[model samples]
Every structure is written in C-alpha cells, then in structure tokens.
Target: MGYSVVKMKIGNSLEEDIRRIEAALEVVPSGKNLAVDANGRLDLETAIEYAKALEKYDLFWYEEAGDPLDFEIQAELAKHYKNPMATGENLFSMQDVRNLIRYGGMRKDIDYLQFDCALSYGLVEYLRTLKMLEEYGWSSRRCIPHGGHQMSLNIAAGLKLGGNESYPGIFEPFGGFADNIAVVDGYVGLPDIPGVGFETKAELMKVLRSVAE
Candidate 1:
C-alpha cells in the first residue's frame, strides 16, 4: 500500500487496455506514476496504435510492447510517444544490451534499462553490462534491474542501481524482500545478512538451509 509506482500488465485488447489504464489514472493521485508492461506481445502496428492511445495517461513507461529483441519496433514506437520506454529484461548478455542502446531508439533522458543479473549469468557479467552502459552514456540510475530476487536486491545495494523489481504477491518465498521488511514510503532496508541474504527470509531460508546441509 506504500508503493509510489505501480506497473500493470497489458496487451490483451487494445481498447480494453486503454480503458483500464485510463480508469486507473482517474484513481491514482497526482505525483504517483503508473507503468504498464506488454511482455513483448504486441506487434509493431498494434504497438504504435496503443502508444498513441495511451499517450494521454502519461504513464511512467510503456514496456516491451513488441518482441524483446525487436529494437526497431521499440524504436518506432518511441518516436510516436512522449512517455518513457523500457525493455531489455529478456536480454542476457552485454552485447544484446549494447545492441538495444545502439539501435533500440532509447533516449537516455527518459528511457529505462531493465537488465537482470541472475538471468544473465549472474553479477559477474552484469558488472560488465553496467560498464558498457557507461561507455554508451547511460547511467546506472537509468537501470532498474529485472530480477526480483535477493541477488538483485544485494546488487542494487552494492552498486547503487536505480532500483530492483519485485513480485510481492507472486512466486512466494522467492519473489519478494525479507518477510518482516515492509516497503516503507516505497523504500525497504536491505538485510545485513551476508551473501544475497536469502537466510533472512523464512520461507526462502527453509529451502536454502535444506540445500546447504
């Protein structure tokens, strides 16, 4: 309930999605941002249409409206809309993310990068990707990483990234912060426990302890 940002899933029906988003906008107070994810499901034409329709909602970002690898589609959509664009969650390598920067029509002033460390061969490689961002003139602040795991949380803490994603109501035991921790005013304190801190979460700790022993 303390969340300042909300991301909704779309791409089901263009009209329905627009109405839904518009309805939400009516309830969301000013100063709060609402983002929407299409999960890379829309085709280019549909994506462009939705982009025009959704412009009025003033979304924080419209994410992955087409295939994750279709940088051209994303780029085209970007040209038609003023809202921020976000993608790269499915990209698993520095080169892939580099391509997004080079060809994805992402604007550093308003776009977001969502690279996931755990999905992309862990933090070692993710560090390289972060460095690549610097060469491309993108800041770590533009990157709100994709994975919702403790590993991403630790990395965000260590590297001072923009933020980490979370699925608080899904993927129990593995998709959220330490159980007792609350998202206070949209911020949560990281656990002091070492090495990704899974042990601090009761359900997650049960599995971790069982595997370690």
Candidate 2:
C-alpha cells in the first residue's frame, strides 16, 4: 500500500532515512507512487543534498522545499529536483493555492495542488474550493484536501486528482479514522460504507479531553 504517492518524514539525517527507504522498498513491490515530506527541516543546500542521496528512491514529490510563501525558492528547488513537488496545510485560503500554481517565475511549478478546508466551512467551502480549481483550468488537476480525509478522497476521485492524502502523520499512534487506507498500485479506493465510512471512538475523545477540563 505504499503506492499512490505517499510521503513520510525523514527528519534531519539522510543516513537513517536512506536505510528506512531501503527496507520499505523491499516490501513496496513495484510501480507504486511514493514521496517524502521534509517539513522544511533542511536548508536548501541540505535539502538538495538529501534529494540527491535519495535520487534512486524516485520520490514522486517533495513537500515544503522551503517556505510555502517563498515560491521563488520552491520553484528553484523544483527546477533542480527530478520528482514533482507539493505543499499545503500551512496555507490559509484557496488564493494561496492559486498563487502557488500561478507563481510568477514558477507558475505551474507545482505538480500537485494541496489545500485544506476545515469542517467549520462545511460542505460549501469544500465544494467552493473544487469549483475554484476547476474554474482556474485545474479541473484535470490533483488536489490533496487538508482537513477532510474522506471528503478529500471523494473530491480527488471525482476531480481525478493524483490521489488524496492520508490524514494521520505516518508515525502517529492515532492512525486516523481510516485505518484501512492503502497507497498501493498508485490509486486510492474509497470505502463503500455509508457516510464518511469512519467510526470515531466516542469514549477516546472523552478520555483525552478529560485532562483538558
């Protein structure tokens, strides 16, 4: 299930991540989409070095090459890198997504457009984001929804995005509401169950929130 362009953090050093990547590669079979998210942890030079080191890994995209706002820098990185690039979750609006795609020097440097619409906006904003992307000629584009996992998958499938992102951080104990998610074969399959198809553990939230109150 490592296909469909999934990313995992490698932290500061490439040595360990390289080994980890090797181990993962063994089980990944072949022809699965894959990538990495550095979380902007490395300097440009370091990021470049690391990217080169993992060149054999053939990452699908690298996240946050630098700052999200620094389109110039990201574009520069993209120019040098072999794989595609993606970024979001730090941006606050659809305009940010548009600007990245329309970046002056690096317009369209972004291969995949990643954006998030929180639940507060409900379905309206979610649909709005989709409409906006379509209006901008991104109808054939791939967008990774930020806040809504299942919702994002639905949108991705409908819009024919590269694929939706997994909500849980790779190592987090809370494996998100959808544990059945798989990245294999370069595609995502939505659950057939009704609604979002995720069963939230009601008591789990209460247990965690008890310490807050």
Candidate 3:
C-alpha cells in the first residue's frame, strides 16, 4: 500500500495502546503520518488522558474519542488536545452535523471532518453538508469521507475533498477502487469509466448484477 497515513484503532487500554503506538512508530517512517481512531470508546477523563499521553507523537488526528453525539465531551477534549481531531462519521443528518459544528468546538484550521455520504443521506445531503461547512468558514478541503468505496471516492474527486479513506483488503470486492487503478505515493487516480466505475471491478459488478436480478 502506498498510503502516506496509517490509522489504527485505540481505546483498548492506555498501556496497550501506548505499546502499540510505540511499535507502530518504530516501523512507520518519519515522513509518513499516523492517526488513531478511538471509535468513541473513552469517557471524557480517559479521552483527555489518552490525548495528553499521545500528544508528543504528533498524530495526524485523534478520531472519535468519546460518543459521537456528545458535543460537550468533544468540546472539552479540544481544549486539552492541541492536535487535529476528526469525527462526524456517525453523524447522519445535516442537522446533526450542523450541531457538531455549532457546539463541538472543532477548529477549522487544524481539524478534519470525516462525514461519509453513503452512511448518512447520500450525495445530495453531503452537498448540503458541504454548503453548511462553507457557511461556517470551513473549507471543502477539510472534508474526508469515511467509507472506503467508489461512491465516496468519486465525491472526493468531484467535490475536491481532503481525501477519501481506503480499506484495501478489508471488505473484499466492495472496499477498494477500480482494478486498473493503483495508489502511488499516497495518491490514487480515479477511474475514467462512468457511474462511479463499479463496472471496473469484476467481483463488485457480479455482486451488483446478482442483486439486480
């Protein structure tokens, strides 16, 4: 994989997570970025503790340290954590995202937003969300959708988002891009074909056709 950033899930235990982060730091080169996703497992206190402990490594972003809907926790955590933070993957409606922006205490300059269109209300709603972000003085470049699928990839390219997440070997035929495309130096070229390029992936096409029938 030619990924420039590698993200790992944390919140198992502070000691264990530190050990894992240290191990990852040893192998991951200095130029590349590393991120951690807690998936909303830690409480406010624990989240702050982890933030303090991991602050020295200068992670790419700390993701979902507390419950997604808990704006207060997110806001308070921002006060303690100085690095970039990411959330909103679990936020479905534009209203929810709006609330996050209004109350989540997210810094537009340094933090990133991970809002997956597929998981929420599809591309139409995602466009609205982008517009809302713009109204709040946030740039479209701060958005990085969460799904590792071609639909989100297309959104990333067409809308010029920060970047789209990739799950190369995790979800089989549904998780990656076209078979012909490859990631090079942390970047991937989109498929030239039409309609999200699902036809470019043989296995995914088979599944789609089967569902259609």
Candidate achieving the largest TM-score = 3
Candidate 3 per-residue lDDT, tens place, 101-178, comes to: 999999999999999968878788888999999999999999999988888898899999999999998787988888
Query: By TM-score, how accurate is candidate 2?
Result: 0.68
User: Please, what is the TM-score per model?
Assistant: 0.95, 0.68, 0.97
Q: Per-residue lDDT of 1-213 in model 2, one digit per residue for the tens?
A: 344444567756788888877776665553135577777677777777776776666667667756678777676776566666667657655566567666713334346666654431545665666666677666546666644355556656655665566655532333333455565565556676565533332444465577678
Better of 1 and 3 by TM-score: 3
Better of 2 and 3 by lDDT: 3
lDDT of each: 0.86, 0.60, 0.91
RMSD of 1: 1.4
Ranking by lDDT: 3, 1, 2
Q: Per-residue alpha-carbon lDDT of model 1 for 14-98, expressed as tens digits?
A: 9898788878887777413788999999999999998998887777889999999989998898889888889989999999999
Most lDDT-accurate candidate: 3
Q: What is the lDDT of residue 152 in candidate 2?
A: 57
Q: Mark the regions of model 3 whose C-alpha exceeds 4 Å error after superposition.
A: none
* Global local distance difference test of model 1: 0.86
Ranking by TM-score: 3, 1, 2
Looking at candidate 1, what is the lDDT of residue 48? 91
Clashing pairs in 3: none
Query: What's the lDDT for residue 140 in model 2?
Result: 41
Residue 76, model 1: lDDT of 90
